[model samples]
Target: MPREIQKAYKNQTRSVDGKPGKKYWQNSVDYKINVKVFPETRIVEGSEIVNFINNSPDELSEIVIRLYYDVFKKGNKRDSRVNPKDIGEGVELKTIIVDGVNYDLANSDKIKRYGTNLTIRLREPLKSGQDLKIEFEWQQKVTLTLDRTGAKDDTSFFVGYWYPQVSVYDDIFGWDRLDYTLDTEFYNNLSNFDVNITVPDNFLVWATGTLENGEKVLPNNIYKKFLKAKESKEVIEVVNEKDLEGLKLKHNTWNFTAKEVTDFAFAMSDHYLWHAASVNVAGKDVLINSAFPKGKAEKHKKLTSIQQKVMKHFSEDVPGIPYPYPVFSTFIGLRYSGSGMEFPMMANNGGSGVPVTVHELFHMYFPMYVRINERRFAWMDEGWADFMENLVIHKFFNEDKSNSFYSRFKLVTQGTLGTIGDLPTVTSSQYTGDSYGYQAYSLPSLTYALLYQYLGEEKFFKCFNSYVKRWAKKSPTPYDFFNTFENVSGEDLSFFWEPWYFEMGYPDVGIKSFEEGKLIVEKVGYKPIPISIDVVYKNSKKSYSKIIDLSVWKNDNRTYAIPVPNHDQVESIVLNSDFPDFNETDNFFPPLKDSYEEKGVKSSIVGNYYVEDYNIELSIAKENEALVIYSNSWVWLNTILIPKDSVNFNTSDKTGVLKYLEDVSGRDEIELEYPKYNLKLKGIKK
Candidate 1:
């Protein structure tokens, strides 16, 4: 554990309600951005003039603009403390050229340079429905961070946050005050963007929004060829002919326009090998473009398939809500900064493989279109993206892949849930101090998994669709999403979100004991919503499950002894064996000793049922006044005791024996004296 984690855990406190604190939805904002990219110079310059149409009933003063550049160039000293290359060539704010001229507003004084974020304060007090125009020319040489932008080697440029961009203004953080922590994600308002990019003629430009000057920007003859290709829906190749010498001298530029976009990014590459596929996403004829090097053509194809599947899933899952774009481009490149990132119609994904592509593609529906402020409520975007990605992967590749993502996600959620001190969900900024890998990506992904488990697949999907429809093209706070889901599902989700977000705690459950056709399970520590248990009986036989809701209890420790109606017909019980539970290390069954004692009776005991590692042992102990069997690890065990008079017990009536034991136990402690029995079990470390 990191020192920070240990400190947080040691100082952690509990809320009065024993639930995570409440997170209210902040005020929403909408924006329209127009940008232009110079691909050859690797520069993306744009302006976002926002109308502060405050939907909230409160009057607000000045707004703060977050340009992620401050995190890299704080104090203008060029700190080499963090990732050296992330500062890249080092970012510099050339000028705050508003409406083409330098405008120093009163709020501009607060424009302190942070690590990678440039905080520009608004000049005047803007009331609801008021508008402001601000522009700045900033450039980044592009370095590699966890997910934002930079170059992998010198061959590729992962261009994102590679420019001085606007920050988000919401009710929660007011202006998102946290520094650029690696684990935290982003949050921005929805806006329209029109970008005109000028790049080298040899380089192909892939960016957000629609190409405004595709024909005029390309070589005259090549432009004509492209036009013809668009009309004929065929691949148009531009041949290098001696007569086209003049065309080669001119630089080609691709201008794009996009509406209701949260952010803007673009990539330029001369080595790109491009392919386009026309597919119908939600009755809308859209083009899916894949851009990669020649060596990655096969990977691009796989990405296309994943995109197709995601689009299909989105279309079917969210009814009456179609994708609002003419094209969905999936760019695959080695320069990718992270697994994948979402733009308006285009998503830049790492060439890691199909999983990264699928995950990024799903982002188009959440923060990309839903327009949630990602910095404050990253879970809203990342969690939803992860959920959709898992769903699509499962639909295509089956449970194995889905299980892998799910298990990984669970670990993240469990880790975070177990660490954070009791803080209000609204004020609990997990992204603030956390690492980018955990805060920005993994934690949010886990939140989605827990939400899915709590709401089940049907209601959860409905709530998700409702969230998208209600917040599409508009800014929505964490509260807005929670309220929408809760209202639609008619389930109070405060209990679910409180512990998951505000207080970091994971489900650490173990099978306490199993005997007399009954199983007792106890939560060792942490309060997960409901314990999802999977009990397997015989080989190839389907498992039985039960969701143990613990929301009604305040204590962290609770035990439940459920009667097994068919104890005689049972084989073994596994807690959270389905991988739904976030923390599984502490999850096991039939305490080893109890399992071993029952092992000779045509029954098998399993230990570390959830995790691959760990060992199981069986032993005997004395209980009550009778001799009984026990498991070495009482974490998950089952004990069987025989009556003193039944020395010659009939083996023919195993069911009867279990039934009699159940009647005698009746959910209470069974007093028995027993001799010790030893059984050993082991497994390879995972």
Candidate 2:
């Protein structure tokens, strides 16, 4: 279905069954940055030297650099709808050196710049299995641009994409030509960094890499607390108000180093709150931390606890893989949009709720560990993160909240499921109009949740863990994700992928008719949906979920019959099963067996009859396997949906004088031998 990534498969760089091909290869680099930030002037000057390694079998004629910060520059193409201000000057190249020779990139006619992408022409071809060192000095006026990498105030800043980063060169798309839009989709190769940051006194630096000279930069009192916090599981205040008030200021350089990371980012603030903690995940001390402004530290008091839980959940639950990074942090500062952005080891977040904390921290396992290009296939990372977000919320917070508006509010109410102007999730993030966030975030998340439900937790976890582990630290196309699930689950999931990703639609399964032990359902929409069956027979009552594969509708067969085995004289067979059905009119068996009272009697179903005079939309809510009908208009029904504690609740007799109870306002009243049209049912709540 994703024909765009087939070239990697054809070239043997990727396999059809979700594994890296025998000829798989990727380019890497080692970058060192020495930068000084003038917070007062809002300017940044940096010198970077990249040791680029071209280990691929082919030769290279040129290189591409990603000047992502240029998205803030005027006249550049941006995915963000916000207006661009020219307060931040575009990157000014001061000097350049290639290997041992100096190249005038500022005046070279061979160097080309277009928007955020720069194409550098090489003097000589860099042959296969060769390494080249490229150095450059540049400066840019720092602007706290919207979305990410912004300054909360003149003296506090979060810096990212400030330096020109080497773009990825892979077997699939040459040079990773995907443009650096405003947000999402950072396709990159694994790179190491050794950064030295120079800042004025009273400034604290938080970076992506591990701090090497913390003992030198931090005050002795705070440095002691920092060391103790990394080894301890409890939250430790590294810098307190006393230290802030008693600081002896001077210029200092903070040195940091990291290996096998995709990129490097750092935040410097003069008056910000810092919280540090640690969690033992996969036998390693992975630091759990958060950084925000003063007086707002209480908003994120439980952030580290949420991080610990998410780290343990994603590592032990579905897709059980170890936490790969040495640190995980949340940095919330002045963000225009109240949102969160995931970075390796750290996240630029806004909300402080535990669910949000879990969502951002779980991203480390996704694009951070399982390095998928978020630009082209945001669903790959966001979908998985959101899916796990609900799962953790279900297991830890409330299971009822997992599939409801209370937990995943953005998911159940929006996206491709039941919204207008929605596009296919497989479409690139740049082209999907209006509903890109919904399609990218929640639709595919629910799709994967449904897939997990269909496969059962065991098979689902096994397949998911295998896929993530296979692609850990590697850039994988979406096809790799599809193929791996099919390979590990031992089922061709093209039925699941095609409709959910390539097609633009939602699930609209309708019950056609029913008789004896067979019920037929019409697939009104292309999505293959799971069906729930609750059968109360004369002999026994059985409640079981049936997962119907998409292959059932592959042949243009719009209908399929599910035979209820050994269940005669059935009482009910509810469809949609309360799983966020957009329309619920045709959701149950015996035609219409739901009872409701919204305002007055808008419609009624006495026994097995549905009235056409005044009708209402009917849906079934299955909580803990008990059926509760939800109605758009007030209505009542008889001979179906009885209370669980009623005298006839377990009865199989069709003709029985059953006493029922109802609540008008507060008091409960009992009625017997009432008209079926005006029947009162128990367990009714408004």
Candidate 3:
């Protein structure tokens, strides 16, 4: 552990048993903000008054504030490329006040501006258990390049990170001073918000928090539909195209209030469709809404329905926690074609699809509700979201468990091992660089899934729920998470946690040899993963499979031997595991090979031989002195099958072997030795 974390433990701010220390405390703020949007001018003016409470033991002279929109400022360092059109003077500060004393704008020593962070030298030191009030007035221009927060189109916008707020001061870190580089997400203090947004008449606002005065801003008929949708079991189209054709707003100010949330965002458009529905979660009606461009209403029609299913699945099934927020909304228009971003109670999604929707909404349980530090430990949030997405997809969409994206992620993970892309999870998002996506989304998620399978459903949720319950709405470091799981599971999981979270290595187990009545397996990788083996008998040609639990690696053993019933009769043995193995070619006992025989066939007899009964088509065409046999039914058959005297051919690989026979009476036959699927077809040449 680092010295800062050790100091944190000594100070009793964080405990060893995976719970907040007795003296744990964090600073927070209460914000009252008002903003006005000018769609025609692409400008947003904002003002805020914040009441900051100093809950930490030591806090003094200076306070840091984050200006998130400064990523668009000229000459600012950014991890993501921004459109040149979006570049401009960042957050123009018009006024700054501290505890009713206005600071001079021309004072050089009083304020320091660097990157996205603004340091305000306080006139008087703020001691422990004290509070101060501050005010700020600023304006920023919205950009056409739709990032997490920008204009999605000419009339549609999703606004986030648009406020001037104090940075987080926690026990682990004095003050989170990391710059908003547009690559990493964020870390924020949970606080209360009272926000009022003003837009032109006929423009509708869907935001983070509950709309405190919906009836005041919306038309009477539209407000009625919104109210009915909250209680109705069916989806209600509150703001359809027909409603927008003649829609007129009675008032322009939209009031909203949210408590104990990390951040807030809102989406507004003059011609967007709004669909909403309600679902029972933890005996409470949680409203789910979807907003999309009016032209793409048909594409996003099922968004609200999918959100309803995701909410219920998360609440009642795996992880098994009640929905944390009162409302869930998804805004489905981004500048990119395929992307999504998650906010407190809202999501800005690009494509109207199930996978992205499931992945984004599942984030509520991670960084949103659990309050993990996404800037430092993105894996804690993104990984779980990625892992749960496949589970939800498999459960609700009936996707095959073996064929789900989660199971297939091993392919992607293994390909990156020993390469620059295989960075450890403990590395910060900024330093991970090219490997950021894999480290944050694949490694941790796959490890968590393996741990889940190791500890059955009951024990896994017990530990999972405890972690969420303990850290909900509070920031937690990676150690806090590891300690919590270890404390709950009543076991030291250092062997499992170290290599996966901190070290740079991969998981691989291969068959060493089969001797006497025992088969020897070697641990070829650093990670401790479960083992799966399949054995075939020579006489009966029957196969027997066995799976060893992950606990077998608890002792850090290098090799293990398992007794087989008929070791001498073992014809072939194959080892397969879901864990991301760097090299799977060595898993076979005798080692699998990819060798094909050369069959020179005459290309003069060019004909199409297809099975009319099964609707399987095969076309043989001569191209560049080679015969290309294309089979429309199966992928393996679409290969270059060289012809010899226009008669017969054969090819074999580890996956399957193919054999073809041509008869003179216009009859042709094909045979494939596909495992568990033996296919033989006899067709006539046409």
Clashes of each: 57, 4, 5
Better of 1 and 3 by TM-score: 3
TM-score per prediction, in order, is 0.69, 0.80, 0.85
Which TM-score value belongs to model 1?
Answer: 0.69
lDDT digits (tens) for residues 594-659 of candidate 1 = 543453322221111221233443333343322333343431233333321322111110111221
List candidate 3 segments past 4 Å from native.
Answer: 335-338, 402-406, 515-518, 534-546, 562-572, 594-686
Q: Which candidate leads the pack in TM-score?
A: 3
**Local error of candidate 3 at residue 526 (angstroms):** 1.7
In candidate 2, position 226 carries an lDDT of 90
Choose 1 or 2, whichever is better by lDDT.
Answer: 2
Tens-place lDDT digits, model 2, residues 487-521:
99998777778777777676777778887667888
Predictions in order: lDDT? 0.52, 0.69, 0.78
Which of the two candidates, 1 or 2, achieves a greater TM-score against the reference?
A: 2
lDDT of 3 at 91: 87
TM match of model 3 to true structure: 0.85
- Please list all clashing residue pairs in model 3, or write none if there are none: 600-643, 600-644, 601-643, 601-644, 602-645
RMSD values for the candidates in order, in angstroms, are 12.4, 9.2, 8.0
Candidate 3 residues 467-567, lDDT tens each? 99999888788889899999999978888888878888778887787778787888988878777776778879577777677778788798888888887
